[model samples]
Structure formats: structure tokens, C-alpha cells
Target: MKKKTKKSFIEYGVIIAIFSGFYFTGLHTEVLGFLQRGILATGLMDPDFDKDSGHAVNTDYPEADFSMKLIDSKGENVAMEELKGKVIFINVWATWCPPCVAEMPGINKLFQDIDKDKTAFIMLSVDQDFQKAIDFNKRKGYDFEIYKSNGGIPSMFSSQSLPTTYVINSQGELVLTHMGMGDYNTNEFKEYLKELY
Candidate 1:
């Protein structure tokens, strides 16, 4: 009788231990999967700064004043002049471009990190349908303002390619223009913005 009681106690202990191990393992796996998803979703997860390609030309950016119509997600019209006294990042992109889609989250991250009172970011969609641009902004939950450029307005800025970004200083001078997608939220880009102020 004493031997049977001891065997029964040992069997219960083993069962409890196995159950605890499985429970902890399943919990850990779930937590790790959630962390991985979070990292992949946010642009701030990585700090890799891509160097500007040699093709970037340091042309003297001309001082120009132009008016464009920006429609918010709510369909309200915002004028370009209303954004004066703020550093503006004007990105020209189309929804179909893969590089443009890839660069969007970085731009959104940069917009979120900056001082909003002093800086303004605008994405100008070259898509034919303005509603598509509005939908994209809604789906992405982007914080930056988006504008739909008129037919001749984009040509005035000398933007020849999709995913081009122009950084305008506080004084409204077009300063830096990048041809392709880049890590706009990097420390180096922030330093360049600091110089403008």
C-alpha cells in the first residue's frame, strides 16, 4: 500500500510538470510572434541610412512660388500658401510604383518624429484619380498632408520621375531634391533639417 501511494504521487507530479512546460512554451511562441509582427510593421525598427546615389545632382534649386490644391481625407481643400513658414517635404509619387510604396512608411515616420509646429510634409499624388490618393492615405493611416497636383504644376517643379522628394526650407526655397526612394527618417536627414532652421 505504501509503494502504490508513492507511485501515484510521482505520476501526478510528472503530469503536472509536462502540462506546465507546454503551457509556457505556447505562451512564449505567441509573444514572440506578436513582437516580430510589430517590428516588421513599424519603420523605426531599423536604423539603416542609405547613402544618396551619385546620380543625385546638387543643382541650385530655384526659388519659386506656386499654388496647388490639396484635398484632405475629409475632402476639404487646403491651399499651398497656407503651409508657409513651415519646412515642407513635397514628395511626387504614383500609387503604382513599388519604390514609392516602399518609401511611404519612412516618410510617414519622419513626419511623425519632426516638430509639427515648424515642419510640414506633403505627398503629391500624380495618379489620375484623386479618390485613389485619398483612399491610400486612409488605408495607410499616414499623418502627412496629401495634395493632388494640377497637370502643369508638377512640370513646373521639374520633377521628371516618380518618388521624387523636394525639401523646402522655412523661407520657401527649394533646397534638396532626391530622385528616388530613400530613408527620409534617418539621423543624417534630421541633421540636414536642423541646418535649415
Candidate 2:
């Protein structure tokens, strides 16, 4: 019985030490995000958009709030109106949020698959320290056009979540608002965006 207890204690200590190492090195976020990415593979994290429902790009919501100010990677100020596309995919995220990190790969894939002329992908970083978001983007090589918030974010995109996705159609209508991590690189999603364009 004592031998078994000693073995259990040693196992627990090793586990704790490993976690402590991850935390101190600022790798805990990535580790946790990796675990959540596994969940994303199960197709459970895919956004809820029914193409057959005819409301895939919801036409019911109010106009999109394009009042938020942003700074580009080159430290240049960008106007919201400058982002011209048939459809706009705006995602609000932070580097430290595990779920945000988990959903980014799928988003990056979606960005690559879509037609740049028809769709604009805006990865808006809300990290308190903008440098962290910039560094994280560089390390991940997601190649997304990431921006940091320069001023107050509009209320329409506001949510009680770390990652919120707002889709806007050509008419500037806020079509869909998904408030969580999502697998957006599906053929159905591609077709849905194409149709809007």
C-alpha cells in the first residue's frame, strides 16, 4: 500500500512540474489552445449556418458598426471604409485566449480558400499589449492581415466572449454574429460566402 502511494505522489509531482514549466514559459496558452483545437476537429466547433435555411447570411440584423478604429501591421491608421469587399469577415480576438488561438488555424485556412476580391478577412486583435498579438501572428505564420484596436470598439460586435465573429454582406448589413470559436474552412462555408458576393 505504501509503495502504491509513493508512486501516485511521484506521478502527481511530475504532472505539476510539467504544468508549471508550461505556465512560466508562457506556453500554457498554446498547450490549452492545442487541446481545444482537438475539439475543433470533431466538427462540433463549426459555426451554425444552414445554407438551406435561406438565411445563411442573416438579413435581419441592423447595419454593421464600422466605427472602430484600427492600426495596421505597418503602424498605419486604416479607415473602416477602406476595407472594401463584397463580404466582410471580422473576428475580434486576443493572443492569450486559448479558444481564440484554437479557432485561428481554421480561420486562416478559410482566408486562403476564399477569393480576396470578394471577401475581406479582418482579424482584429483586442490584446491589451498589441505587441503580443503581433508577435503571436508572426510566430504562427497564419499570414492573416491582423490589426490592433486603436479606439473604442463598436457595440454591435460586442459580446461576453473572447472570440466573436461578425459577418457583413455587401449592403453593410450585419448578417451573422457568432460568439465563439468556429471551424470555418468547410466547403459549405466557402459556398455560403461566395453566394453573398
Candidate 3:
């Protein structure tokens, strides 16, 4: 009985240590996000039918101007003001972020559905490796414009979290600001963009 108790304590200690490591290293959040995505994909969890679906983008901010200095994929400096007179969709995301990766397909679908001539899509990656951002875009076959912040990002758009997105109207006012992964391919989201134009 004493030997069995000792072995059980050791096993518990090992399990505790492993979980603590994962929690401290931020792997726990990633793991949970992965599981959530898997469950949603399996149809066991209804993503679209949820009455209080957290997957929808939250848009309740007052209209405000957006300005940013960014480097385009071609290494040319671009200003947000230059993108005025067009509906702008700005996404600050990183390739390593699981939520960012998961929402990318929806964003791409939105990009394809919109009129390119009247709207601009800027997907700025915050990856440490600039080349990795470029490579990821290429590998994913996303034709939407990719960029990196060249100057300080506005506080309104800044977040410690990855996958923040902003929608600005042609009149240079922010229409919506969203944080975290959301389904952007829905008609509701498309209607919001249409209203911006």
C-alpha cells in the first residue's frame, strides 16, 4: 500500500509539473485554441447557430480616423492617408498565432468577395522575420496586400493580442475594430463593409 501511494504521488507530481510548464509558456492557450478549432470543425459544436456566438466580430467603437506608417511588401513606405478615399481593411496578425492562422481563410474569402478597385486590404504581419511573413503569404496563396509597420501603430489599433483588425470607411473614419479570430466571410460582415462604402 505504501509503495502504491508513493508511485501515485510521483505520477501526480509529474503531471502537475508538465501542466505548469505548459501554462507558464503560453502553450496552454494555444492548445485550447487548437482544440476549440477542432471541435468547431467536427460539427459537434455548431459555430454558426450559436445564439451568443463569440466567433462573430464585435463592432461598437465610435468612428475615428486611422493613420499608420507601414512598409509594403515591395519595401516601399506607405501611409494610411494614401489609402484614403477607399474602404480599408487592416489586419494586424502573425503567422505563428493560431487564431490569426485560423481566421485568415475567412479574411481571404472577404477579400475575394469585395470590389478591389473601391476597397483596399492591408494585412500587416508582426512576425520577427519579415521574410517569413512574405513566405507565409505566398505559401497560403493570399493575393491581398501584405505589409509591416514602419512606425508606431496607433493606440486604437494596438493590442497585446494577435489578429486585431480594423475597418475604415472611405471618408477616413474607423467603422469597426475587432480583436481575435472571427468569421469575416459572412453576409453580415459583407454588409458592414458595403455600408462603409
Candidate 4:
């Protein structure tokens, strides 16, 4: 009888161990799935502007003469020279970039609220598919002039990352280059724009 009781205890122990293993495995899988879904929902795989480590570009690079064709929301061809004599904010972005999408609405609002007669906001998409940019702008209902960088306009400006922006003075000189997006309507940006005029 003693031996039979010992065997029964061991058999129950094995069953409990197997059940615990399966339970833990299932819990781990659920946790992993939840994490994956959260990342996809937030679009966190795209590049982000690290505000803490970001450095401002000094107005020291030699003036570069570059021109490109821009397509408006209505699919009209516009020359870059049309923006001459105006303080221009040129943004280099891509549709797949999350930070670019987030900053775009703020830039649009800035354009609408500011004195458009003096300042012009230029959005140049570096996406390989020009149609993707057009579709994105259309879905977002954006009003800024969208352009394709066919002549390497982004590389000419020394942009190393997506969503880079350059502030040009009225004299057609690059004054400031921001590696990341900031508050476009803030006093800091307004003051910077005022310097061009």
C-alpha cells in the first residue's frame, strides 16, 4: 500500500508540471502578440527626430543654386524659381515616414495662419513613387505645394535623413537647417522667418 501511494503521488506531480509548462507558454505568446500589435498600430518602425540629441545646422554651407519642378495638389507644374524673393521653408519627407506625417499638419497650419504673401512652404517628397505622394496629400487634404525630387534636390541640400527642413532667406540663401520637426507656429520659428525678410 505504501508503494502504491508513492507512485500515485509521483504521477500527480508529473501531470501538474506539464500543465504549468503549457500555461506559461500560452501566456508568453499572448504577451508577444500584444506587443507586436501595439508597435504596428503606432507606426513606430519609421524614423523619429530625436529632439534631445538633435543639433541645429549653421548657415555656413556655400550657397547652392538648385531648381526642381513642383506639382500642386491640383496637379499643376510649378517651377522652383517662382518661390524666389520669398522666405521659403523646404521640407524633405516621404509618405512612409511616421514623423513626416505627424509634422505635416503642423506645417500646414503654420502656412495658413502666417502671412502667406511673404512666406512660402515647400514640401518635397523623396519617395520613389511620385503617385504615392500625390495620393497621400490628397487623402490628408493638404494644400502645400508637393514636389518630386528628381534632380536630387534633397541630396543637393545635404539632407542625411527624412523629414529634414531648410529655411531659406529671401536672397535665396540657406540660413538654417533643422534635422527634426519643431513647433512651426511658435515664437522661435516666427522669429527665424522674420530674419529672412
Candidate 5:
């Protein structure tokens, strides 16, 4: 009995040590994000346009704040206003965020499948060191355009979560907002976005 107990303790210690190494080396974020990708694959986290998600469909959607500023990879400035008259999909995220990393692949897939002429997809990175985001994108080989905030984020774009998403229609009204990770690359979501414009 004592030998069995000692073996169990040793096994637990090894597990703890492995986890500690992962955490200190910052590998846990990707590991956790990989685990979360499985959950995202379940399609339970996808944004629902109909349900009372943060801003309900029936309630008045405030005019989208076009004051948000962004800097593209080429160091070009962009304002929300520049994307007017088009359906917009804005995702606020960070490299250290596990859920954000998890949903990114789906977003890129959606970006590839969507009609770019009618819709604009903005991959907004909130990382303090924007270079980290740029490097991560390069490492992942995602083709979606990435941006970092150039100035203060507008009040309407603010959320209590890390991976929040906002959808604005061509009419420039805030139509939908979802807080948290989501599997956005789907026929249903694509159709819903097309319907927005």
C-alpha cells in the first residue's frame, strides 16, 4: 500500500512539474488555446445574430463609433469611417489570449471564403507589443489583414472581454456584438453577414 501511494505522489509531482514548465515558458497559452480549439469545433461558441447576445436584434443599435483608429502592417492608418458603406467584422484580441488564438483559424477561413468587395474584416490585435502580433501572424501564415490600435478605442468598442466581436451593417449601425471565443467560419454566419448589408 505504501509503495502504491509513493508511486501516485511521484506521478502527481511529474504532472505538476510539466505544467509549471509549460506555464513559465509561455507554452501553456498555446496548449490551452489548442484545447479550446476543440471546444470551438463543437460550434457552440459561434456568434448568434438572432438571440439576445449583448445587443439584441429588436433593440435600437447605436450608430457605430467610427472614431476607432488602426495601423496596418504596412504602417498605414485606418479609421472605422474608411470602412463605411460596407459590412464590417471586427475582432478584438490578443496573442496571449488562449481563446483568441483558438478562434483565429476559423476567422482566417472565413476571410478566405467571404466576398471582400462587399465586406471588410478587421483583425485587431490588442497586444501591447504589436510586433508580437505581427510575428505570430507570420508564424501562423494567416492571410487576413492585421491591425493594431493607433489611438484610443471608442467607448462603444470597449468590452469587458478579451476576444470580443462586433458586426456593423452597411447602414453604419451596430448590429451584433459577441463577447468571447467563437467558431465564426460557417455557412450560417456567412449568410447572416451577407444579410446584414
Candidate 6:
């Protein structure tokens, strides 16, 4: 009877371990925010920064055209068409998203380095509370061109993900679509942007 009870305990332990693993992997809430911060600290959560694969160019999904009034921090309307002739980098994210917060610094750095005249960095906030987004950016001292989506978001730039990014070329062509956080401070990514600009 003692041996049978011991076997049952081991089986239950194994089951608990399996359940815990699955739970951790499935956790997308603030419960995993600490884990994400740790990963970022260790430089393990860099953006899947790529230039070769469907990122720098997409022949099929060319001409990414969209008309949306992106409201600036000063309550000014910034039309998407104003940036048509420039290489546009649009990041769809919210202030509350852990992955979005984690990847922002790299994006800010990229924005600082890129040619402002030739490239337009549009950080579209998906936040329900637009003030919170602006406040977060100000508190973080990030100088991204953060805007609120005031109209219909185009299919080429829309995603179910909280932190999706799309790169549109100078000719208003869709070049890349990144579904999550990425390390945007890479040399390869900069070079690709240079080529695009």
C-alpha cells in the first residue's frame, strides 16, 4: 500500500509540472510582465529584425494605400497621405502591452538615427485611452511620432496582435509586416531602411 501511494504522488507531481509549463507559455497578461522585463534585460527579447524575408520587399502586397486622420499630441491632424512619398514605418501598439513597452526603446533609437526627411516614423497608439499613451511617452522621454488612429485602419497595416509593425516604401508600397516585438537597433535593419529611403 505504501509503494502504491508513493507512485500516485509522483504521477500527481508530474501532472502539476506539465500544467505549470503550459500555463506559463499561455500567460500573456501582466502576470508575465516581469518575465518579459527579465528577457529584455538579458537582451533575449530582441525584435526578429530581418531584411531578407518578405520584410524589405513584398511584391504581392504592393501599394499600401490608406487614408486615416492620425491625431498628434497637440490635437493636430496628421494625414497619412502627407507621408506618401517617404519611407513610412508604422508601429501599431498600446502603452499597456508588455511586448510593446519592451520593444519601444529600440524603436525610439531607430527613429532617432533614421533620416527624418526621407523616412516617416508613425507610432500609432492602439490605446483606448489616448492620454495614457501620450503620458507614457512623455514619462519615458521617448520622442516617437506617436499618434492616435482617428479613422479606418487599412488592411495592410491592421493586425489582431497588440504590437504589429508595417513598413511602407517611398512609393506607398507595403514592404514588411512584423507581428510582435523586435530589436530595431540592428545594423541590417538600418541598412535595409537606408536602401528603402
Position 182, candidate 4: lDDT: 44
Question: What is candidate 4's lDDT per residue for 1-197, written digit by digit as tens?
Answer: 99999999999999988767756654433344334444434543322222311124335543535476667656677777888878778888877666566577667876777678888887888788888889878877877778775454645565777678877767776666667544464555565576666
What C-alpha lDDT do the candidate models reach, one value each?
Answer: 0.68, 0.83, 0.74, 0.66, 0.88, 0.78
Task: For model 3, state the Cα shift of residue 156 in Å.
Answer: 1.9
Candidate 6 residue pairs that clash: 47-182, 47-183
Total backbone collisions for each predicted model = 0, 0, 0, 0, 0, 2
Judged by lDDT against the true structure, how good is candidate 4?
A: 0.66
Q: What is the C-alpha RMSD of each candidate to the true structure, in Å?
A: 12.3, 2.2, 6.7, 11.7, 3.0, 6.4
- Tens-digit lDDT track for model 6 on 1-197? 99999999999999999768756764343445445656665655454544543334556656787687789987999999888878888999987788887778788989989999999988999888899889889988998768998887877677999788888777677777888777777777888887776
> Which one wins by lDDT: 1 or 6?
6
Most accurate candidate by lDDT: 5
Residue 12's lDDT in candidate 1: 100
In candidate 1, which residue ranges exceed 4 Å CA deviation?
A: 1-61
The model with the greater lDDT, 2 or 5, is 5
Off by over 4 Å in 2: 50-59
How much does candidate 3 score in TM-score? 0.70
Which candidate comes out best when scored by TM-score? 2
Question: For each candidate, what TM-score against the reference?
Answer: 0.65, 0.92, 0.70, 0.63, 0.92, 0.75
- Candidate 6: global Cα-lDDT? 0.78
- Please report the TM-score between candidate 4 and the true structure: 0.63
Task: Pick out the ten consecutive residues of candidate 1 with the lowest summed lDDT.
Answer: 47-56
Error of 4 at 115 (Å): 1.7
lDDT of 1 by residue, 90-186 (tens): 8888766655676777788888888888777778888888787787778779888777754346454557676788777766667777786666767
Range of the 10 consecutive residues with the lowest summed lDDT in candidate 4: 46-55
